[model samples]
Each structure stands twice: as structure tokens, then as C-alpha cells.
Target: MPLALALSPFLVLGFGALLIMLAEAFGSRRGGMALGSTIVLFATGLTAAGLWMYGLENLKGLEAVAPWLLLDRFTLFFQMLLCLGSALAALTAGGYLPEHELDRGEFYALLLFATFGAMMVSASGDLLTLFLGLETMSLGAYAMTAFRKASPRATEGALKYFLLGSFAAAILLYGFALLYGATGHTDLAGISKVLRAGAVKDPMVVTSLVLILVGLVFKVSAVPFHAWTPDAYEGAPTPATTYMAVVVKAGAFAMMLRILLTAFGDAQSMSWSAGWPPVLAGIAVLTMTVANLVAGRQESVKRMLAYSSIAHAGYLLVGVVATMRAPQQAGASVLFYLLGYTVSTAGAFAALVLCGSRGRETVSYEDLAGIGRRHPAVALPLAFFALSLAGIPPTVGFFAKWFVFRAAVESGFYVLTIVAFLNSVLGAYYYIRVLVYMYMREPAVGAPVAVPMRSGYVVAAVILSAVMVIVLGVAPSDTLDVAVAAALSPG
Candidate 1:
């Protein structure tokens, strides 16, 4: 394959970001930016699919950018995932921004740029590229969090995110510096070679590993590092929150996988007796338990979903821990779970977006009271997504959890799996509560009820996401096959 073809996905997104930025500055019409962003994202996804079909490793000149960016099945998988996620977010924004009177071409531009950064994160093969991608993604996210300039909540959330994110970045960079000092290598593969050559016992190596894990855990919003999540999610525009929930999380996980597997996959670092798995398992248990417990207490629906996102990250961490013992199956499980999670989460947020208009947006459980009676079209899909998030049968969320737990079982993590299952049950309570409010409860007398917004963009996103959740849930073989293939061919 031509080098251009090998790099098509990245090129397409990069170029699209530039074009969208130019359009935002020069174009008169704001109506088309969302549509334009959607088109670019779809095109980028198709490009990744094309590369996957062509077999990324077989392509000549793929190493033209060797040690910096990798064109692999894993990268392609995340590229497609990020593109689809960003497109859905863009569609949601099309409805959400205008309804809330914050529509601007720049929002779409920032979204594209953020997505481009995420793609870079997935494709990165070197620490330099990874850090670059991380900051790029983080900057866009900070701006998006502050998009609602008139809202003090938005400003506070953005400020906290920016400050904390910068601190995390500094920690990560210091870790990288320590690694370089210890091994004299910055490339992940080179660092791995050094470790495998018997540098693993170095105290500096261990310290660096601890620092790096802290940084990555913060990015994923794991427990103790998750204080910023609910506030940011609740304060940002709905569409931006959705993007953060899916795309940003996906990118962070991608980066984590790359670093851990490539640079720290040695026996000492990977061992359950001594390595990262035990730590991650503990984090998974705490993240799931804490998030679920707190989520059930949240009065705001969006904030509840934010905690739900953290809980799902905990589930993904279970799969991550399993990778220490069953690399292929556990890794595939992680990819598949994220695929299911991306659609289910995006759908849930879209449903939330549809459940409200400008002044009457759904916030509390009471705001959703009688929504099913008022608009079954909106309520039905919301119910489906909510049930799916709860891991109900015949939904993608169920299968996703099944795969992760199966991987854990195969890896001999019985206690962790049991705890996760119990947490899943606990999580269902909050999700089901939303449905009960919508279907069973009635609004208080004279209280403002949430009204469904009318927008083809939001409806399209919701329907597509819901259908994907169902289709992938019912017949996941093809998607699973792709995930397995990607997993077997590690970056």
C-alpha cells in the first residue's frame, strides 16, 4: 500500500480539522459545521476500515514514521471508534447547541480537532507522540468544557479540569523523564528491550512506573482521581459531555494499553505476584463500588451518567488486569467492551439530549416524570439505552460485561469478578430509577416538565446508536472477530 493510503485515516482527520477551523473563521453559515464535521468523521472511519481490510502490517512505507506513529489493527480499531464517537457527538451537538442557544461553528471545529488528537493518541508509538496527542486532546476538552461562557458552573468545571489535567501531565512527563534516565530510551519498544535485558529491578524504573500509572489512572477517571468527572460532565454542554465520556475515555485507555503492553510487558512488570495487575484490580474494585454507590445518590441525571462512565472504566480495567494472564482473550474483551460501551454510552447521552429542550432540560429524576406519557418516541429509546447501561439481557451492555467477566474468570480472578458482578447489580438500581421516574412517576403540580427537543440530527444519532447497541448485542460475532484479530496483532 502507498504511504498515503497507510496514513489516510490520520491525514483525513488532520486535514479535516484544518479545513473546519478555516471554515469556522471564514465561512458565513454556521448551520453546516456539524454536518460537515459528521461527514469528515465518517470519511475518516471509512478510511480506517479500508486500511483494516487491506492489512496494515503488509503495507510498505508504514514505517516511514517509525517509532513515532504505528499503523496497526489496534490503531485502526480505535481510529474507527473515535471517529464514530465524535460523529455521534457532533450530531448531538447539532441539536443541543442550537436548543441551548450556544451553537457556533467553532464548537464543531474544536470537536474535530479533539477527535484528531484522540486519533493521534491511538496511533502513537513513541512517548513524544503520545504526550503530544494527550495535550492536544486535553486542550480541546478544556475549551469544550468552558464553551458555555455565560455559565459559572461551566467555568468552574473547566478551570478544575485544566488545573488538574496539567498536574497529571506534569506527573506523566516526569515519569517519562525518569524512564529515559534509567534506560536511555524514550521509544516504548526500546524501553521494553532495555527492561527485558534486565533493568526491571531498578528503583528508578519502579518509581517511574508508579508515576506513569498514577497519570494514566487520572486520565481514565478511576477512583481517588475521579473527583473532577461529575462536575465537568454536569457543567459542560450535553454533547461535549458525551464526547468526554466516550472519545476521551477511549483515547486514554488506548494510550494506557500502548504504554503498559509495549514498555512494561516484561515478566517482572506483568506478573500477578508482583506487577501492575494487582494494583489495577484493586482500582477496578474501588472504582466500580464507589462510583455505583455515589451514582445512586445523584439527583442530577447527567451527573449520574458521569459516575456511570467511571464505573464502566472500572469494568474495562478488569479486562486490563486480565491481560496479564490471558493476553489475547482479555485484550479482545477490552476492545469489544469499548465498542459496546461507545455505542451504549453515546446513545444514553443522546437520549438525555432528546429528553429536554432549552429551558426544560431533564436534570433530576422528577424532571423526567411522565416523559413516557408525553413522548414515547423519546422515552422508548431512552428506556432501551438505560436498560442496556444496566446490563439488562438482550442489550450490548450485557454482552460487554459478560466478555470482561469471562476474561477475568479465565484469568483466575474469581473474587474480583464476583465483586464486579455485585457492583453491576448495584448499578442497575440507578439506571432503573430513571426509567421508573419516566414511566411511573408524575411531575409535581405546576412543576416544569422536560419536553423532548425536535432535531433530525439528534434523532438520527439516537436511532443509529440504539440500533448498533441492539445489533451488536444480538449478533456480535463479526465485531468480536474483528476485535480478536486486532487484539492478536498488538501494536
Candidate 2:
């Protein structure tokens, strides 16, 4: 394939973003901007899927972008996932912004740009490109977090996110500098070769690993570095929250998996090379345990979902650790889980958006009481989404966790798997609690009124996500095959 053709996904998103910016700047009518953004994202995803069908290995011009952008099946997989997830967020925003009177063309533009950056992150093969892509994505997220500038909560959350994110970026940059100094290469393949050859005995490499790990885990919202997550998720607009929860996180996990596997896969002998896995495993334990415990205590539903995102991060981490022994299965499990989690999470947040209109936002459990009885249409999907999150039968979340836990067990992490399973059980309480309030409880007599809004965009997102959830859960062979192929393929 020609290089330009191979790069079509980037070109379409980049050009589409610029076009949207121009139209938003000059055009007074912003009615279809969300739809436009969604179309561009769908086009990007379709192009990526086309590349997957054509096969990345058959392409010749890929050398032109090598050691920077991989353009592999793995990258293609994540590109499609991010685009699909971001497109849903765009659809949600179509309904959300207008109903809340925050409808502006800028949100769609930022969403496109952010998704473009996430695509870059997934395809990045070098530290330079990785940092650039990560910051590009973060800047978009920070701006979106503060999109509701009139609200103090939004500004506060944005400030916290920005300041902490910048610090993490700085640490990551320093780690990259040290890594380059130690290995004389910024390309992940080169670093891995040098490390495996044991050419570098520099203590700086160990320090750099810690720094980089800190920065990476923060993006995934893992514990000890997850302080920004709840506030950021709670304060951002619902669509923005969905983007952060799904797309940003998928990029982070992609970044983590790539960097760890490519650059530090063989930093030392197989005896806990670089001492990363044990450290990561410990963090996973803390993340799942702490987040599950705290999530159940939250009064605000959004904040609880924020914590839920953190818990899922921990679950993904377990899969990462499983790669030490069961590389293919573990890696495939992570990819498949991300696919399931993407749709499940997007649907849940959209249902949250759907449960209340501008004046009747669903803030607490109390706000959701009797909603299932009041709006069965809205309540039914939310119930399914919540069941999925809780890992109930026949839902995607059940299979997602099952795969992860099975991979962990096959890898000989019996104790870790048990801990994760127990944490999952504990986590189910909060998810089930949401359904309970919606179905069995009743709102207080004098409580603030909340009503479900009607919007074609959000309804489409919910229905589409719900269907995807069922398809993935019931018949996952095809998706798992694709993930396994991506996992086993040479990067």
C-alpha cells in the first residue's frame, strides 16, 4: 500500500478536525457539528478496519513511518476502538450539550482532535511520539473538563487535572531522557534490544522505569496516582466524562502495554525483569481493593462511576501481569476486556445522561429512585449496563472479567486472582445498588425534580452500545481471534 493510503485514517481525522474548526469559527449554525464529528470518526474507524482486512504486513511503505508509528494490527485494533468509543461520545454530546444549553461547536472539534491524538498514541513506537500523543490527548481532556467554565466544580476539576497531568508529563519526559541516555535510542525496539543484551548497567534506567510507570499508571487512574480521577470525571460534562473514561483509558492501557512489552520486556533476566511486575501487581491490588471500598461509600453516582473506572484499571493491570507467563492469552484478554469495557462503560454513562434533563440531573442514588418504574425505556438499558458492570450473567462484563481472571490463573497467580475475584464481588454491591434504587426505592417527596430527556442521538448511542454488548458477550470468538492475532503478531 502507498504510504498516504496507509495513513488515510490520520489524514481524514486531521482534515476533518480542521474543517470543523473552520466551520465553527465562521459558521453561525452549529446544528450538525456533532453528526459531522461522528461521521469523521466512523470514517477513520472504517478505514482502519479496511487496513486490518488488507493486512499491515502486506504494506511496503510502512518503513517510512517505522520506529515512530507502528501501523500494526494492535494499533489498528485500538484505532477502531477509540474511534468507535469517541463517536459514541460525540453522539451523546449531540443530545447532552443542547439540552443543557452548552451546545457549542468547539466540543465536537476537541473530541475529534482528542481522538486523533489517541490514535497516535496507539500507533506510536517511540518515546517521542508517545509523549507527543499523550500530551495532545491530555490537553484536549483538560480543556473538555473545564468546558463548563461557569461552574466552579468544572474549573476546580480542570485545574487539578491539568496541574497533576503536567507533573506526570514532566516525570515521563525526564524518564525518557534518562532512557535515551542509557540506551542511546528512543525507539522501543532499540531499547529492548539494548536491555536484553545487558549493555546498560546504569542505575538511572531503574529510576526512569519508576518515573515512567508512575506517569503511565496515572493515565489509567491506578491507585496511588489516581487522585485526579473522581473529580475530573464528576466535574466534566457527561459526554466528556465518557470520553475520559473510555477513550483516554484505552489509550493509556495501550501505551502501558506497548512500552512495557517493547521497551522493558527484557530489561534483565526473566527473574522479575526490571522488578516491574511485582510492583504493578501490588498497585493492582491496592487499586481494586481501595477503589471498590470507596466506590460503595460515595453519595454521588458520577463520583462512584469515577471510582469504578479506577477499579477496572486495576483489573486490566492483572492481565498485564499475566503476560509474564501467558503472554498471548494475557495480552489477548486485555484487548478483549477493553473492547467489552468500552461499550459497557459508554452505555452506563449515557444512561446517566438520559436519566435526567437539564433541570433534573441524576446526582445521587436518591435521584434514581423509582426511575425504573417511571421510565422503563431509560431504566431498562441502565439496568443492563449496571448488570454488565457488576459482571452479571449474559453480560459483557462477566466474560471480560472471566477472561482476565482465567488468564491470571493460567499464569500461576492464584493468590492474585483470588484477590481480584473477591474485589470484583465487593464491587458488585455498588453496581447492584444502582439498580436497587432505580427499581425498588422511591424519591423523597421534596427532592429536586429529575426527568429523562428525549434525544435521537443519545438513544442511538444507547441502543448501539447495548447491542454491541450482547454480541460481544454471547459470541466473542471472532473478536478474541482478532485480539489473539494482534497479540501474537510481530510489532
Candidate 3:
């Protein structure tokens, strides 16, 4: 395939991100027509079309367009997810803005840029490119989180996220520098070779590995590194929160897997499987246990959901650990979980959007009272999402968790598997509690009742997310089989 054709999806995303900036400059006055929605849809369409062409022409694996990027199947897989998630978020914001009187073009622009950044991260083949991509995505995300500049909590969330994210970024870059200094190469493939040659045992390499793990741990919200998650998720704009929860983590983990599989995949290094696996296993155990236990005690629905998201991150780390121990099937499980997570979380957030008339609710647990009686559509979808998060059967989350556990048990990581299973049972309590409030309790007197669904974007997002969750949950065999085939064999 032609290089331009290979690079089209990313280039389209980049141009689209910039286009939104241009539109912001010139189109600020014309905010009422859902122009933000239009731009996102058009960009998403462009991305889908480009990827379709690539697939039709048998374009798979890395297509090196520069020293920085490697357009490959792995990258395309995440790129498609990011674009779809971003489009869903845009539509969500579209539906949400009008009701809240905050409909503005810049909101869509930030969403596009954030997605574009995620695309860059997936496509990156070099550390410098990855760092650049991370910053682009992070910066855009911070802006979106605080888009409600008027809200003190929103501003506070943005500041906390930004400060902490900046620290993580710096640590990651330092780690990259150490890797480069030790290996004398910046490309991922080269780093793996250097490490395997005994260079990674050097003190510099050891320091670099720990620092790099710290940075990624922060990204994945692992225990001892997850303090900012609940606050940020609660304070950010809900649509932004959804985007961060789904797309950002997915993108970050994609890179995390790539780095582990490529740059660090050297049995001779002693750090590849031996070093990281136990560390991750420990982190996963604590992350799952702590997040779920804390989540169960939260009074605010949004805060509780935020903790649930953190626990899910721990579940994903289990999949990552599987990559080291059971390479082929485990990697596929990670991708599956990411897709499942994106769909379920997006659907759940859409329900939250419906409940609030202007922006999100104060979101007290009492706010959910009588929703099941008054608004079946919103209430049921929320219930489905909560069930999905809890890994209940007949939901995609069940299959996602099942695969990870299967991979772990196959690799003889019985203890980790058991802990994860127990966490799921613990998590179900809080997830089900929200449902109980919605269905069993009486509506708080004069609580805001959900209005009718409005906007094509809103309807599309909800329908698409709901359908995906059910279909994937019921018959994930096809997708899982394909992902298995595509996954690289563990080192």
C-alpha cells in the first residue's frame, strides 16, 4: 500500500484536531447548530473510511511512515476504538450541552484533539513520539475536564489531574532517557535487543525500568498511584470523565502492552517476566481490593462509579500480567476488556446525562430514587452498565473477566485469579446498590425527574453502546477468536 494510504487514518485525525482549532477561532459565533457534533462525526467518518480501505487492501502490521510511527494492526485496533469512543463522547456532549446551556464548539474540538492524541500514542513506534502523543492527549484531556470553568470543583479537578499527569509524564520521559542511554537506541525494537544483550541489568537500566513502571502505573491507576482518579472523575465534565475513563486508559494500556511485549520482552533481562509480573500481580491484588472496598462506602453515585472504574483498571492489569505469563491469549483478553469497558462505561454515562436537566446532577445516592418507575430507558441502561462493571453473567464484563482469569489460571497464577474473583463479588455490592436505589426506593420528594431523550447524537450513542454491550456479552466468541488470532505470541 502507498505510504499516504497507510498513514491516512492518523493524518486525518491530526488534520481533524487542527480543523477543530481553526473552527474554534473562526466559528465561535456559530455555536447553536451543533457544529462540534458535525466536526467530530465528519472526522470519525474519515477515520472509519481510511481504516476500511486499509483493511480492504490487506494493510496489517507496521507501516513505517517515519522514524516515529509504525502504522500496524495493533495500532489500528486501538485507533478504531479511540475514534469510535470519541464520536460517542461528542454525540453525548451534543445531547448534554443544549440541556445545560453550555453547548459550544470548543467542547467538540477538545474531544477531537484528545482522540487524535490517543491515535498518535497507538501509532507511535518510538519513545519520543510516545511521549509527545501522551502530552497531546493529556493536555487536551485537562482542558476538557475543566471546560466548565465556572465550577470550582471542575477547575480543581483539572488542576489536580494536570499537576499529577505532568509529574507522570516527566517520570516517563526520564525513564525513556535512561533506556536510550543504556541501549543507545530510541526505537522499541532496538531497545528489546539491547536489553536482551545484558544491558538492562546495568544500574541505569534498573533505575529506568522502575521509573518507567511508576509512570505507567500512574496511567493505569494502580494502587499506591491512584489517588487522583476518583476526584478527577467526579469533578470533570461527565462526558469528559467518560472519555478519560474509557479512551485514555485504553490508549495508555495499548502502549503499555506494546512496551512490555516489544521493548522489554527479553527473557535474558530477568526483568521482563520475572520483574514486572510479580509487581503487577501485587498491584492488581491491592488495586482491586482497595478500590472496590472504598467504592462500597461512597455516598455520591459519581464518586462510587469513579472507584469502580479504578477497580476495573486493576482487572485490566491482570490482563497485562497475562501477557507476560500467557502471551497469546492474554494480550487478546486485554483488548477485549478495553472494548467492553468503553461500551459499558459510555452507556452508563449516557444514562447519567439523561438524568440531569442542566449538566450533571449533584449525584447523591438519593438522586437515583424512583428512576426505575419513572424512566425505564435510562434506569435499565444504567442497571445494565452497573451489572457489566460487576462482571455479572450475560454482560460483556463477565466474558472480559472470565478471559483474564482463564489466562491467569492457565499460567498457574492461582492466587491472583482467586483475588480477582473475590473482588468481583465484592464489587457487585456497590454496583447493585445503585440499582436498588433506582428501583426499590421511593423518589426523593421533588427530585428532578429525567426528561425525554433528545438529539440524534444522544439516541445514537445510547443505542450503539447498548447494542454492543449485549451482543458482545451474548456471543463474544467471534470477537475473541479474532483477537486471539491477531495477538502476538508472548515472549
Candidate 4:
């Protein structure tokens, strides 16, 4: 295949970013940028699907980029997920920006650029490409976090994220350098070969693995590395928050999967008796338990969701750890869970966006009082997504958790699975609280209540997300089959 045909998904996004940037510089009409970005993302998704249909293994010249940019089923799967998530976020922003008086063509440009970075991260196969993609993605996110110029919280959040994110990036780079020193290679496959050849016990390799895992843990907002998440999520514009919560998390996990399985996948390194599995299990427990406990106490719904995002990461980590014994099942479970998570999270945020208009935006639980009685269109979806997040029956979230837990059970992590189930029960309280405030409580006398905003963009996003959540929940086999095909072997 031609280079352009082989990299059509990435090329489309790259072209779209440049086009959006140029339009921002020269055009006065800012209204079309979001639509254009969404169109670009949809086109990118189509390209990825086309490649999958065309048989990625048969694409000529694909190996020419080997160990730097891999365009296999795994990469294509995340490309589709990233594009879809970013598109929904763009649609949400179309309404959110105008309503909040932050409308700017550059916002869309940044979104496109950030999405391009995430695509790169998903496709990366070497440490060089991986670091490049990570920084590119993080820089755009930092800017987006602080996009609201006049908001002090935005500035604070951006500053914290920039400082901490830069630090994490540096640590990851140092780890990569150490790995290179230990194995004399930057490509993950090469490193894995070296480790399997008898260097698994190298102190530098262990240190590099620990440092690399730390950087990735921060990206996923897991436990102690998660200090930046809630503040950043709450301070950023809602649309940007949605982007970070879904697209950014998905990209980080994709990179994590590639690195851990490709570079450090030796039996000794993946072992439950002495390796990443145990460490990740501990992080999973801490992340779920801590985040859930803190989330229940948050007054701001957005902040609560931020913690919710962290808690979900813990659940995904459970699946990640299960990969040691059940690579295919666990990997597919993680992918499907992320798919469910992306839709459910996007819908939840979109519903939150719809629950308020300009000057009456919802923030606190008090603001949501009586919303379900007045705005069934907004309230119903919000309730559905909330329940989904809590992993209730007959929703996509339920199946997502079920798959992950099932994988863990099959892998004999009975204690971890039980702990995760308990965390799920604990998590339900906060998610249900949102619904309780929406349907059961009444606003205080003379207090301003959030009114539903009217925007076709937001409505479309909510509908798209809701439909996916329900449809995938009802008939998951097709998606599961695709996920199974995408799973990579540790070797």
C-alpha cells in the first residue's frame, strides 16, 4: 500500500489539525471549526475501520516503520476509540463554549491537535515515538486546561498539571534512557528480547520498569499519582474535561498496554510472585478505594466525576493485572471496558452540560435539585449515565465491570476481585447521589436552579453516546470479537 493509504487515519487527523489551525488564523467565522473537527475525527475513524477491513497485516511498507509506528489491529482499535471520543467532546464544546462565553476557533484547533497527539501515542511502537506522542498530547491538554483566561481555577489547574506532567515526562524519559542502557535498544521488542535472553534481573531494568510504570500511573490518574486529576478536571472547561477523562485516559492505557506487554513481558517480570502484577494490584486497590471514598464527599458534581474517572482506572488496572494469566481474555475485557467507559463518561458529561445554560450552569448537588422534574430530556440521560457509572444492570457499565471482574476471577485473583466488587458497591453511593439530587430533592427557596440549555450539538452527542451504551450493552459479542482480535501476545 502507498504510505498515505497505510497511514490514512493519522494523515487525516494531521491534515485536519493543520486545516483547523490555518482556519483559526485567517477566518472570522468560528462556528464551523467544531463541526469541521468532528467531521475530521469521523473521517479518521472511517479510515481506521477501512484499514481493519482491508487487513492490516497485508498492508505493504507497514513494517518499514516497524518498532516506531505499528499500525495493527490494536492501534486501529484505539484510533477509532480516540477519534470517536474526541468527536463527541468537540460536539459538546460547540454548545459549551458559546454558552460560557469562551467561544474561539483556536479551541477547536487545540482539540484537533491534542487528538492528533493521542493518535500518535496509540500508534507508537518505540520509546522515541511514545515519548514524542505523550508530550505532544500533554502540552495540548495543559493549554486546554487553562483555556479560560479569566478563571483563576483554570490557571491554577493548568499550572499544577504542567508542573507535575513535565516532571512525570522527565522521569519517563530517564527510565527510557536507563532501559536503553540496560538492553542497548529503544524498541520494545528489542528490549524484551534482551531481557528474555538473561538480563531480567538487571537492577537498571527493574528501576526502569518502576519509573516507567510511575509515569504511566500518573497519566492514568491512579491513586498517589492522581493528585492532578480532580483539580484539573474541575477547573478545565467541561468539554476539555470530557476530552481528558475519555480520550487522554484511553491513549495512556493504550501506551501502557503496549509498553508493559512488549518490553517487560518476560515471565519473571510479569510474574505475580515478583513483578508488575502485584504492584499494579496494590495500585488498583488504592485507586478504587481512595477515589471512591473522596468522591462521595465532593460537593461539585464535576469534581466527583473526576474522582470517578480515577476509580474506573483502578478497575481497568484489575484487568491489566489479569493479563499475566489470561492475556487474550483480560486484554479484550480491558478494551471493551474502555469502550463502555468512553460512551458512558461522554454521555454523563454531555448530560451535565445540557442541565445548565449560560449564567445558570450547574456545579453543586444543590444546583441539580428538581432538575429531573423539569427537564426529562436532560435528566433522563443523566440518570441513565449515572447508573451506568455505578455499574448497574442492563447498561454498558455493568457489562464492562462484569468482563473485567470475570477476567480477574478466571486468573484466580479472588481477593482482588472481591475488593473491586466492594469498591463498586461503595462507588454506587456517589453516582446515585447525583440522581437523588436530581429527582428527589427540591431547590432551596429563592435559589437559582440550573436550566436546561438548548443546543443541537450537545443533544446529538448525548444521543450518540446513549445509543452506544444501550446497544453495546444489549449485544456485546460483536464488539467483544473485535476486541479479542485486537489483543496482542506478550511474546
Highest lDDT, which number? 4
Q: Write the per-residue lDDT of candidate 3 for residues 69-169, one digit (tens) a residue.
A: 87656676777778767777876787777666676677877787777788888878789888888888889888888888888988888899999999998
TM-score of each: 0.99, 0.98, 0.93, 0.99
Runs of candidate 4 exceeding 4 Å displacement = none
lDDT of each: 0.92, 0.90, 0.79, 0.93
| Ranking of all candidate structures by their lDDT, best first | 4, 1, 2, 3
Which parts of model 1 are misplaced by more than 4 Å? 488-491
Clashing pairs in 4: none
What range of 10 consecutive residues in model 3 has the weakest lDDT sum?
56-65
lDDT, candidate 1, residue 140? 93
* Model 1 per-residue lDDT tens digits across residues 335-445: 999989999999999999999999988988889999999898999998999999999879999999999999999999999999999999999999999999999999999
TM-score ranking from best candidate downward = 4, 1, 2, 3
TM-score of predicted structure 1: 0.99
> Model 2: per-residue lDDT, tens digit, 172-264?
899999999889999999988888787545687888888899899999999999999999998999999999999999999999989888788
Q: Could you tell me how far off, in angstroms, the CA of residue 25 lies in candidate 1 after the best superposition?
A: 1.6
lDDT of 3 at 103: 67
RMSD of each: 1.1, 1.3, 2.6, 0.9
